[model samples]
Target: MIHEKFTKDSIISLSNLTVIKEIDDYTIGDEQKNIFFRVPREAVYVIEEAEGHNTIEEIQNSILQNKKIEIDVLDFMNTLNNLGVINNISLNEGHRNNFIKNLGKLLFNKTTVIFYIINILLTIILLISFPNKLTPNYQDTFVLSSIGLSLLLFFFVSWFLVFVHEGAHYLAVSATGKKMNFQLSIRWFWVVIEANMNTLWSISREKRYIPFLAGFFIDILIINVSFILILIINDIFVISLLKMVALIQFYKIIWQFIIFLRTDFYYVLLNYFGVSTLTKGSISYLLRKISSKYSLFFDQLSIREQIICKRYSWLYVISLFAICYLFLFFSIPTVFHTLKTTLNILSAFAYNTFEFWDSFIVIALIFFEFILWIIAAYKRFKRGD
Candidate 1:
């Protein structure tokens, strides 16, 4: 809630504000509310001067003297107050300092980089030296005699690794003195685990990269460790299971590179370009151009961003076509084959037999994944995302 009135004589103080400069405007706000606004650079300077030491009148006069612009200090303070930026609430640091002190050294140091490099080199050398043993095979996923049991085990292990991957991201953001939200979400037709750290916008671009790429780093580590274990172990079952895990991790890494899907790497690219809403802006611009029925979202963008979106809109259109191609050629056929195989097994095998259970479990898992996707989609729609 905001105070009802303010006088020019009143001293002004701002909440903990994050002001990041972009191509044309500055993104400024309090991260506690996860709310931000794009203000001009002059407004940012005014915000910086509102540190509770000066009266609104003095601050306005100072800005007039320094920047030769006469701003309504009272109106500006009222606007900031309405936006929850000029508040008396003290944010809880809550072990953030400790987290930065500890995890910062453990995860973001030179020693860790060297260790990661060594692991990568060792993994490469082992793969080259024993290509046959290191290469992933589909048969490795069916290590158990019962196909149903093998698939269930694989599914559980894959989900556990997903948890670890998201955890890495959570920890990285925590190290930067921020919190991240974890959710079960859907990406197109696939159910995915996600970590939402929108507050990262309040942080510097360089610090933001680690959190975005943390999952990829963890996946690489898992792959390397799995390969190392495969070389050290002679048991066929152990080797096969390790190979399956490594394969899944490798697939995840590749999936992140699918920029059209808005993967982690996509966020990295957005940060690198210092653009906040490139994907959404580009898609909306393309839509508005095709049909005026759409909202004037594209017209609302800054000139610099409008140009960027116009250039990227063509690529966005191509990616949409590519998605349609993949659905027609790959996704539909794969689902069709799985259902066909399951139906045949169900018809041929007795109800109590392992073959019947295998088919039943596969169908059940597919249904479960579909239900999850539905739930995620509903949540997204409700939020107007």
Candidate 2:
């Protein structure tokens, strides 16, 4: 939900924005930094980009005029959406109705909440109906229809989880009385609400991780309950549940090991290293470790991490490059794979809706990824990283 035109050090000054006109769901504004808008802290980075005084037309043009949304861009937008981020809007009252400015924020917030509630419900329903709905086989047409209907019902569910994820961050930081900006994010393909309080760098790591991690912990809790529900409902509705389209809801839960795609696993790795940032430094360390000359730097590292770094440093580098390249160079295959799965889900209205191939491909890819992960984990584990 966040937008930006990255042109150097532009910072939006709210005073400069004037609602030039309004048309239906859209509003036109003159861009400038003078008029500071009250955005959730997370969205300020994009807001920072709006400082160059490009008109609304220019912003829209950037999106529409472009052809393919490249992997870097997709990643950027995805990051904006999925990570806790916010959008900056014209803040001054005179520019437009004061309450109206809040419209976007309110709508986005509600969207996030609704997503979480639905995920909880659907995940639970799918589980109790387990292996039946989620399995690779179902022969009846009527059962297939039921499953298709279930998926249709749950198709638009996800952003709510993101909102909770971000809201936890907002509340966590707010609890410490830290000032934060609210922003929505689109990390990869997911939309999220975010609280911007990087300023909390001054806070201890535990405090920071509490806010950073609250969302995933909650997700794990939901997954566990869903697993229990699968057991509870197994005897009564296993076959019927299979007929329902809500199966495969637990795949994400099952494949947590793939641990790519900037999920909580990434956070766990970063936390393990005690590094505040990973995207930059991890890469640097990876590049340097290739040379024996940097062995001294590795030696200088803390006993625990030095061993980890020295051992899996190559894995760290490869993983970083792989993610970036998978996103950029292999964008076509990635998008194609995503689209193929989407179509398969859509076809559930007619087909069996269960296939060995479906879970196999996804889970297999993750498994392969884990095999590589073992290489890194082995070094870390052996060295106590």
Q: Give the whole-model CA lDDT for all candidates, comma-separated.
A: 0.77, 0.42
lDDT of 2 at 321: 60
Each candidate's clash count = 0, 43
- Per-prediction TM-score, please? 0.80, 0.38
Give per-residue CA lDDT, model 2, range 1-385, as digits (tens).
3455433232333333332111111112222222111222223223333453654334334544553221232333344334323235543323333343343234234345566566667655655676553432212212323333333322333334446555655555455434345643434443334455543443444445554544554564455454555455756444444332222223233322333345555655654555322334334456565865454554554555554544444555555564554445334453455446546665564334354344344444445545645554554456452
Worst 10 residues of 1 by lDDT: 325-334
Q: RMSD for all candidates, in order, please.
A: 4.1, 17.6
Residue 118, model 1: Cα distance from true site in angstroms: 5.9
Best-fitting candidate, scored by lDDT: 1
TM-score for candidate 2, please give it.
0.38
CA lDDT for candidate 2: 0.42
Deviation in angstroms for 292 in model 1? 6.4
